[model samples]
Every structure is written in structure tokens, then in C-alpha cells.
Target: MKRRDILKLAALAGASAVVPGVLSEVRAGPIGHTGPYWITIQAGWGWDPTLFCDPKGAPVNATYDKAQIAKAGNIPYAPSNENDAFFGKYASRLCVVNGIELSTHQIEAAFRQMWTGALEPGYPSLAALLAAGLGGGAPMPLISAGGFEETAGLVPRTRLVGAQPLDWASLTAPSADMASLFSPMTETRIAQYRRERLKAKLATSLPPGIKSVIEAAEAAELSRPKLEQWKAHWPSPLSDDPSRALIQLTLAAFKAKLSVSANLWWMLDPAVTDAAQVENFNDWTARFDVLMDEIEAFGLDNSVILVASSGGGRTPMYLDEQMKGHWSVGSMLLLGPGIPGNRIIGGTDENLRGLPLDPSTLEPNPTGVRLRPAHIHRALRRLAGIEASAEAKAFPLDAEDLPLFS
Candidate 1:
């Protein structure tokens, strides 16, 4: 495998790749129809819950003072100038999670803990563990686009830093050129001959374990139709809206069954990377509207696990009218299978301190456990219907599974 490519196949007990003449055996789950795709959209810099999920009006955060707080079913959301449309249209499918406290207030430590539920390395990302468990035989089990999508080696994952159409082309061919993978084959018989020759050699010279690799490559070479279909469905990546461009790629990977799941981080224009900038939220608002629109248009709302979360929340105590420092408590949203519509779980005070809750009832309790990202993730695993899998068991959440989804 190439250095950047992640391919960790389970080695057969007795199969030896080192021996030139000995045949190696291998086993992998078979691929079939898959749905309820899992996705995690990490906004990177935390969002201010006071302006949204953990709604704290005025005195606490003045930015959303006049922005009417809208309630869709049971979910209360601040109808900010930009994101009102989403709340009005899809709040019925949303489950807002608030009062999430991170492990620390320091930048890097908090960022790591928010996603991986740990302050240091060695903890597998929830995305990685879930992908491997649900991934039957997807060529790419996990696809991580944009920011910090560390795999920690639980399964194969692909990271797309920027535009590189040829990267998709390289799936089947040795060269990173689209033409090489999908060019017309006028001499079909010659190709058949080569394949038959390889098949014949497979019984003798080629190790059995290597056969699947060769076959998969050939399968990908014939995937030009799927590529063309994606081209018709996605928008131009070089457009003004970078989020659509990135989301288009992510959606294609999932729809094409190229991967069992994908974790997409939205990297705003360098100028708008700061979540503290109110204007950035406007950009995000518009893009998020388009995101939900496309998801509904593509008919993925019921068949995909759409999650939105961040490192932490920006403090309500603003440095100025525009900038706010990081706060320990953050927010999360879950929308997909088994997640009831318009249910808001947990809460924070006007100052954004998490309230303790009855673990079983998920109601406020004076002396109960506080919520965190790990607790949410543990519930997420159960929602995906794979909490008991060995891959999931490998990364045990220290606390008992949170019953948020139920």
C-alpha cells in the first residue's frame, strides 16, 4: 500500500506473504447494499451555544437578543439572522445535545478530548471505530476530509486535504491519472486474456491473499459509470462556496459506496476560520442551509447519520461585541435513524455551566453525572446498532452507555 493509503487487512493465521511460492489465505466481509451512512461534521473552532442550543438570552450573550427563539416540536433554537431557515425547515428531525463539558480549557487538549474523549493520544476516534464495525467490504472503510480526523489505526481511512480528482482515479490504476483508470479498452479480448492468465497464475505463482487485491483493482477500473454519475450530481469544487465543494466530495464517497462512512470537517476560508467572528456564522448559516437542502434533496435524511459538533463552545463572556473566548461546555446535534425528532437533551445555565442529570431519566438532578462528548458518543455507537462489536468494545467508554438516543 502507498504511504498515504490506509489498508490494514486482517492477515490469515498461516498465510505467509514472505514466501515466494507459498499461497497466502485471507478473509474479509463481503460488500452489499449499505445505508444509514454515518457522518460527523466537526466545525473545528467551537460554536457559542448561548446563540443556539443552550440558548441564553441577553445579559448572558447579547448577540441573539432580538433574534427570536424558535421552537420546533421540543427543540428550542435561537433563530439567528443566518440559520433561521434550517431551524424552521428541519428542526423536527434534529436532536440538540447541550451541556457538554470538555476535558480542559486549553486549546489542543480540549480539541482532542471533544472528539476522541481523551486528553492524549492512544484513544481511537469514534469515527474510526464505527466505520470498521459497519464497514462490510467497502474499499475505503472511512473517509476523513478537512480537519483533525485521526484514525489511530483502527481501520482504513482516506484524508483529502484539497482538490485532487486524480486521487479518485488512482483507486484502480498505479498512476494518478484519470485516463489510466477509465480509458476505453478496444481490445477486450486482450484484457480478458491477461485476466485469465492472472487467474491461471493465481493457482500457482500468485498467493491467494493477493487475489482479492487484484480483483478489487480491476473492479475499480470499471467504475467509470459511477464516477460519471457523481460528476452529474455534485457541484463545481472551485465555486465560491467551499463548503458545498467539500460536501459534494464527501457525499459522492458515501453514495458511491466507496466507503461505509465519512467524517467531514468544514474548513472555512482562512479569513473566517475564527468562530468568534459573528460574520463567520452568517457564512456558516447559508452553507448549512444548503447542506440540509442537499441532504433532503438527495433523500438522505432518514438513511444517514448526520452529526454536528465542535471542540467546545465559545464563552458567553465576550472579549468584545464580536470575539468570545473558549468555554468548557459545548454543543452537539444528531439527526438520523433512531434519533427522535426535536428532542433536546441536557442543558446549561445562563452562564453555560452544565447541569447534572438523572442518568436513567436524563432529567435534571441536583447530584447527578454531568454530560460529556464521550457519553454522547457512547450513545451514538448504540444508535448505529454496533455498540457490542469488538471494534467498539476495544475503546470502552469509562461511563455506562448514555441512553440519549433511546
Candidate 2:
């Protein structure tokens, strides 16, 4: 495909999710990495606990029954009727944390707290932090499928699919006409110009954020081969669900040994919840099961950290027996290496209200403080072994440590 045609296609997509970096010469080597991939699966909008994680507290006459609550060793999960497929495959490895309130009623605030740990600016999403910490020398350390993802520090984001995925594919391959543009003399001149421009740009006083962008631009100029490497491993059948497609892309990156973390999201449409809750969660969990299978097959199971979270929790089953607005509490699931499996943390009243949990014990503590995104942030920092570093420490968790987890 022609390079202009690719750009045209990308332009047609309305908005662009630009991959951060410069776009000039080809990169010399494939981006590879050791183990330990941190991945976050977003159960966005508001999630129904009865349908997936907190079924135990659902009303006695709700859509899901207590009998459906299954135990695989020590894990107690209340999956919707249609979610047997997901629970069946992942129950053993799952660690379900309940009654942890995100402690916010506002949607936007909830979103910021869920991913970034704090309500303040300059602190990027957990995915960005992990990518920076885990991806030592990779150009694209962080990858996102659209969430509260940001580069708080000097790290760069990679929107490979961008405004148009098909156009992105073209970037991985250069047609004969496109290749002809790169001649020896032209390459030398362009490289020299870039160096000079970079030096001049550096000499000027620029904000840290702008400086990072400039640096990313320089890196992008030389990421052609890396993009091509990604294109070569792109999954076929990309899938109708954007999140699943991201899963494929993330898995492909892992198999190619390129990145350490990727973020994904799933939606909870309130209007459709009354009728489609069962089908929705069944599909979501099933896709997650597929991800687990792929990770295990890659022999990186112990090196991977899988986190499932959301911005809000759904209201109780009411009049029509469907979930409604956001609640102060929600659920989070953590699986993968070093994380204890088959355990449930925190608790709620029998009526499904979220209560605080002692971070140190991972148990309910009304007298203690409520758990927020910042607390999870710190615990995760400890779990991933980056809590002590200056970068990781810069974004401290709001609550205290959950020693039981460590």
C-alpha cells in the first residue's frame, strides 16, 4: 500500500491514537525482554457483582443464586448462570477482593482514582508506571487500549492500532515505491538534520512533558523496524470486541518478547444491563479465560500479573431486577506470579454494601480506613518490586500497606 493512502485511511477514522515517537529511519533490532508482564483488564462503566465477582452478597432472589457460588479450593466466586465457562477454567488461579470501595461517587473522579492511584495530575496510570519500571530499554514501554493511561514521567505510549488499524498494518510493510524514498545520501542528510534539530530543541527551555514528547519524537524516527516486527506478529481475525483484539496484540507482543505490560477495557452499558448482564459477563469472563490460556501456553504464566478492575460498582438488583447507578464499592481481581491464588479479601454486609478493609490483614475493618486506588497502587508497587525506586515512590498509594498480600 502507498504511504499516503495509509495516512488517508488513518485520517478517515475521526480521531488518532498516535503512537508516541519520531518516524524517520528504521530501528536496528527487535525489541525483546525478560519475563514479568503487568496487564490490567478494565471492567469499565459499572460492574454487577452478582454477575461476576461479588455474587455472594446479591439478593436472595436475584438472577444469580447462592448455590451457583462455586469454590475451587479456597476461592469463592458467584458467576452468572452463563459464566460457567469462565469460572470453570480460571477459578483455581483467581484471587477475588471484595468490599473495597473506590471511595468516590463521581464517575470522572472514580476513573482517575482507579488507574492513577491519586486524584492529582503528574501521576500517570498504573500501566504506564509498570511499563516504565518493567521495560528497561524498549522504545514503547507502555501500551493502552484507551483508558486513563498517561505518561506521568518520561515514558512513552504506543497506540499501534492508532486512528486506523489497517493503516498501522501498512506501516509494518513498505511498498517498493515507499522503499525508494530511502537512499544513502537522503538517509545521511535526514539523520544529520534530526541530530541538529534535537540539539537545538534541547538547548531551549521546555517543560518536562514537552521535553519527553520531543524525546519520544526522536525515538519514533527510528522505530520503523520495530513497528514492522509488531506488524509481522499481528493477530488475524482481530475480533469484533476491541478489548479482545488488544488482548491478542498484547499476547503477540509477549510472544515476540517486546513489551512488559498492556492495558485493556470492557464496558457496562447501563441501558442494556437489565437484559444483557448475563450474556455480557459471560462473554467478558470467557475472553479473559482465553487470555489466561494463551499466557500459560507461552510459558510466561509465572512472569505475568493480571489485574481486573473498574471505575464503579453497580447498584443493587431493584424493581426490574437489573443493576443501576454507581456505588461507593467495587471489586478487583489479581492473578499471576507471586500473588496468592484461591483467596478472597475484604467483605461487605449481607445486603451488598462496601466496607473498609484493613490493608495489612486484607480483612474487613470499618474502624480502619477504606481502601482506595492509591492503596492498591502501593501494594502493587511492592508486589512488582518497584516501590522503593524514585519513580515508583513518586506515586504513593493513598492507604497503608496490605501486609497479608506481600
Candidate 3:
């Protein structure tokens, strides 16, 4: 029979018949250490570190012992004692870090929450550590709320899963090409095309060895219909809001153990201040809380880490005019095994300066000023048993300014 005829016949087979054997071989393995999971929440917006973790409490100055203030900078302590009450409930599980230099923009309310624990900047770094601890593999490092972006940190071009850069726009309105590939109808059509194309091409160049391989692959893909299977496996339709999809995707990735790191970016652009946007943000946050509740239900606290945060600072135009230009500092929170409980670490100035002070040396400079986000990442890595240094080597900073898990 003609090779074209053989190719046509093979295409009639489905993908399951051919793909299963291959997929089983690629499944990820169990975690290397069974250590506690490390969850990192990456708050994209500039999070005011002062809110949840304060140093020397809002009114900071020369009157306050510079050394003492520096030492106490990352610890949550306010003079009026008003802010301290906010985080009283979670005090045991919380460790507030202050005086760490931040590299993003801030909003007022987010800053307020940081000092008071009313708002928590969930981060991605912590999540990556946890996923790694769970024995997942690369290409799934961080799953953002919308999608991954270039600015989302982590060394790009690596084998890390979920490391591919994502833009929020892609989440809401995925490219036509991707949509076509992921669509069931399109896959069916493409399968047909593959069959027809294979036949036409084989008629012209039919090398016996190549023909055999093509026939086998075509027969395998046809027999099982991998695209149909993938369509079936694709997550249930989620809300168009990228944030909601983000939470759902992260949960799915974790449940499937397909990725070791996933970053969920909750809405960051202040431009999304419309009613729809607010509702989307609230809904997404609620979904995130639900995810946490689910994790707790499974008693898998030690297996997963959830870190939350904004992208950059909010613009004055986005906030009340009275609070223009005054951005809030960012925040960080963690809940899982191997983490201290009910404790708040770090402090923020009344003006919202997160100053990190060395309690032992009693000094505060840019290097000593605040809890660097990288320190939190380092701490999480330590918890996960990853030896990577958290702080950027080129940057002058110390991890001691932050609290350690006891």
C-alpha cells in the first residue's frame, strides 16, 4: 500500500494509545527531603513593610535611640499601641520584618495593613520553596495571578517549571494561537490536518526508516487522541478575571504536583480600580482564603506555602487626593510547618519607612535599614532545606535583621 494510505490509516488512531506510555515516563518524582513546605507570596505593588512589621512604631526620630530604634526597626512595635492590637490575634504565628529596603511602589492602605497586619503581601519566592520541598520539578516555579511577567524575578531561561514569563493580558485574553491549540474543536481539526499532511508529504519523500517512524508516531497519536485527553484534563472554565484563574491554576498545579513553584499575582495595576476590578480582587482574595481553608482541611500545612504581595506602589491618582504620592510599604506573611506562630516582626516609621536595625549592634543604615524581601525568601529556602543564598550577593544586606524560624 502507498505510504500516504498508511499515514491516513494511522491518523485514525487516537492519542491515548500512543501518548500514555510516554507521559508516564515524564511524571515528576517525590520531593528530595520531606522538609516543611515553603510558601512565598510575591506582592507586586510596593507593600509598606511598616503596617504588619514595625520598628520603634510610626513616630521615629533622633529622640528614639538610633541604635535601639535600628535594632527594633523590623519588630512590630508602635508608640500609641493602636497598631499593635491589629495583629494581636496572629501574633504567635507571625514574624514581622522591618528596616528592609524595598524595590517597589507602595499604597497607603496596604501600608496601613502592613503595620497593623490588616493586609498581607503574599509572595512567590516562598511558594517556590514549598513546591520544591514537595518534590515537584522545574518549569513550574511561579504562577502569577494574571500570568508570569519578566519583572516577576527568578532567573529566567532556566529549567524551572512555571519559569516562563507571563503577562496578565495573556491570562484574560490568551493569544489566538494558544486558544486554537487548547480548543478541543481546533485540536480535532489539527489532528485531521496532521493525517492529511502526513499522507501528502510521505508520497514525495518516503524513506523506509523515516516512513516507519512517522507511521508509528502517527498511529500512536491517532489511536489515543492526546489533544482530546488534554482538553478533558484542562481545568474547568474559570472566571475571566485573571486573579481568579490564577488561584485556581495554582491550586491545580499543587494538587497535580506538576510544578514546584507557582506565583499567584493578585490584581496589582491600580488602574484596575473600577467596581468590576474591586469585586474581582475581593473575589480572588476570598478564593485564596478558600484555598488556604482547603489546605488546612487536608492538614497539609507543611506541604504548601502561600505568599501574597502587590506589584509596585499605588499612584496618587489611584488613591484619595489627600493621600497622593504617599505610597504604602509592602508586607509578607507565612503559615505552615517549621514556622514560628503568633509573632510579628519588624517595624515601620509613621511616614512609612521600614527600617531594619541590628538588635545586636544597634545600627541602621540603608544596608541595616529594613527587612529586605530577599531575606524572607532566604528564610523560606532554609525552611525548605534549599541551600541557595536568599540575599542578592551584589546587594549589601544582612539576613539577621529578620526573625528566624525556631
Candidate 4:
């Protein structure tokens, strides 16, 4: 028999000895429930909030109505008015917060399609959120589509709310060892591998520099005296394709009850090579819509929360010559369990200045001003069942924000 066949036998023998107990352990306990899942999308660049949710013609709106509109043409697009109609489908389980202000630099691009009511297809924010909230046990996993410099910081924020961060690449492409060893293939390979013990021994040496905790865990499993036991504990089979492997890994993580949150950030900054074009925003949004449908297919809607937001607004660099140095606020949409959906929460000035409106009332704050990102974060954490006292002492904004939580 081939060396592969020999190792397979040894692995199978080891697994048969442990499979029943391990399987029982998995099924015996109650799956830990970590409240709801929450997600926040940061439109890195300035996202024009006005295009999606505008204030009912206040001073800022008046100025834009008289000058900016004539210059920019029908400031609000067709989709802005349909917030209630579209989100209402998931009303009791969703909350749409508009007029969120993000402090960031603006590169040159005019007209904000990033958050202009049109969806970019295949964006993963909503899908990931839904998966986590509905998945039991550990906090929902957050997955990001595009890499970001601030991901480390953003991840901890979710953790504070009791959700875990699902590594995007790993989810898409699970480790080969995790699959080959634990899958049913192990049973088939058991008798074959035992006949070639020498080859199996030679192949088992781990490579250098593999020090991750997960790697260590795998190494420990591989060292088991009974190969069958180790095989039974290995992860399920994985695909050779990286992307397909990731999806499988994500599903496995969910099935294993290991993660509850995932996030995918689609680059919207014009400065980035991969930024979506204005004409393609609709197509992109549609892709995201389809992705959500796929998540629903997983039957995780009841426990998950879907959130969509822009890194920031963009100004089309190809547009009008005179328009320069202007920035727009980003937009956010929420849909999921326990959310109050089918409603727009805040308003924006025609110039995209976010107004300070009560989240419940949707009326302007008499105190005068706009809502800040910090407040938005506070509200979201609340939705996730993270008490204000549990928030990190380190404030994303001013140290004063700590007081708000206290």
C-alpha cells in the first residue's frame, strides 16, 4: 500500500476510539448564546450623507437648495425617499441611522454614489452581521471584504460588544491540514497509512516558524499517540480553491459555534486602485443584495444583525471643475433581529452636514448641532446588549466620551 494509505489507516484507528466521545461532547452542552450581532461600516473617505438622508430644509438645507442643488442638480436621488419602504420589510428587526459624521480627509471626487441610496452588490457587511447575530455561542464573527489599516481597532470595538472577528482570508481559505486530517477521508485513509508508518512519520514534522495558537493546537493534535483520535478531531474537508475554502471555513466556524461576527469592507476611496466607479455603484450594491440572500439561505437571519455603512463619501474627480475640497458624511443601514427598521433615524443638511436628531424621535435636537460617530457607536453597542459600562476606557473620540458610557 502507498504511504498515504498507511497513514490513513493509523488515523482511522485513532479516530474510531474518540469520535463518539467528541461528538457527544459537542452535542451535550447547551450552545452558549451571545446576544445579538452588530456591525459598523466605515466609509474611509467622506461619504456624502445628503444624497441618502437629508434634513427637512434647515439652514444648511436652505443654502444647498438655493445654490448647491442648482449647481449639483436634484441633490437627493430617487432611492433616498424609499428608506421606509425598503427597510420596512424588516422593520421590527432593523434600525436605519442616517446623518452620521465621520472626520476624515477628502480626495477629489464629485457626486456621492458610495452612500447615495444605491446598493453596491456583493458588499459583505450585511451578510456577516446576520450570520453572527443568529449564530449561537461566541459573539458573532465580523468579516471584512477589503483590508483596512483600522481593522485592528475596529475589531476590538466589536469584541467589546461580545462579538468575535472572523478572519476574512482564513474563512475563505481554511488550512489544508485542518481538512485532510479530520474529514471522513481520514476513515478511508486509515488502513492505507498504517502500512507506511515510516513515510507518515517523515511527513508529520511541522515546518519552522508556525507559532500561531491555532497552529500550536493543530500540532498538538497531530502528536497524539493514536492517529484515529487526532483524525476525528480535525476540521472538516476543505476545498482547494482559496475563495471556496474560505466560505467553507466560514460555514464550519458557524457550525462549530466558534464565531459570531464577520465584516467585509469594500474600498470606496477614489484614491484606491479598486474603488468602484460611479456608474458601477448600482451593480455593486446589487451584488451585496445577492450576498445577503445567500446568508439568509444559511438560516441565520433570526440571530444575526446586518449593518451597512460607507467608509466616507466620494466626490467624482471626473465631474465639474469648480467643485473642490468638499466632503460628505457617510450613510449607514441596519437590518436584523431586535432592530426597529423601516425608518430613517436622522437627517443631513443639503451640504451633507449631519444634524443631531434623537434616534427615537427623528426630530432635530433643540440644543443645536449634528450627531457624531461616537454617538452612533454608543447606540450600536446598546443594540448588541453591551452595557455602556463595559465599553473600553479608551475613547475613539475624546476622553470625554468615556463619561457618556459611564
- What are the Cα lDDT values of the candidates? 0.63, 0.65, 0.40, 0.38
Best by TM-score: 2
Residue pairs in clash, model 1: none
Q: How large is the C-alpha RMSD of every model relative to the true structure?
A: 8.8, 4.5, 13.1, 12.2
Clashes of 4: 73
List TM-scores for all candidates, in order.
Answer: 0.75, 0.80, 0.49, 0.52
Over 4 Å off, model 4? 1-35, 39-47, 50-94, 106-142, 149-252, 267-278, 314-328, 358-362, 388-391, 394-406
> Across residues 240-323, which tens digit of lDDT does each residue of candidate 4 receive?
333333333333334444445554444345432112332234333443454455446545556556666665543322234323
Candidate 2 residue lDDT tens string, 1-406: 4455544434443223333223421222336676678888777566766567666633633655777676556656665454555656666777777776675788777877777888766787888888777664575566667667777754666554344444454444423244577886776676668767976897799998888666655656556457656545554434445544556666766666667787876654443364465566766777777777767655667878888887756666464535466666777888888777777776666666767665456666777657666777788888878888777867666567766455
Give the deviation of candidate 4 from the true structure as CA RMSD. Answer: 12.2
Candidate 3 stretches with Cα past 4 Å from truth are 1-35, 44-92, 103-144, 147-249, 269-285, 311-320, 326-329, 359-369, 388-403
Model 2, poorest ten-residue lDDT window?
A: 20-29
State the lDDT of candidate 3 residue by residue for 298-360, as single tens digits.
Answer: 355567655545432322233452232434444456555676665455544555566556544
Ranking by TM-score: 2, 1, 4, 3
lDDT of 2: 0.65
Worst 10 residues of 4 by lDDT: 20-29
Which regions of candidate 1 are displaced past 4 Å? 1-29, 64-68, 163-242, 267-276, 320-322
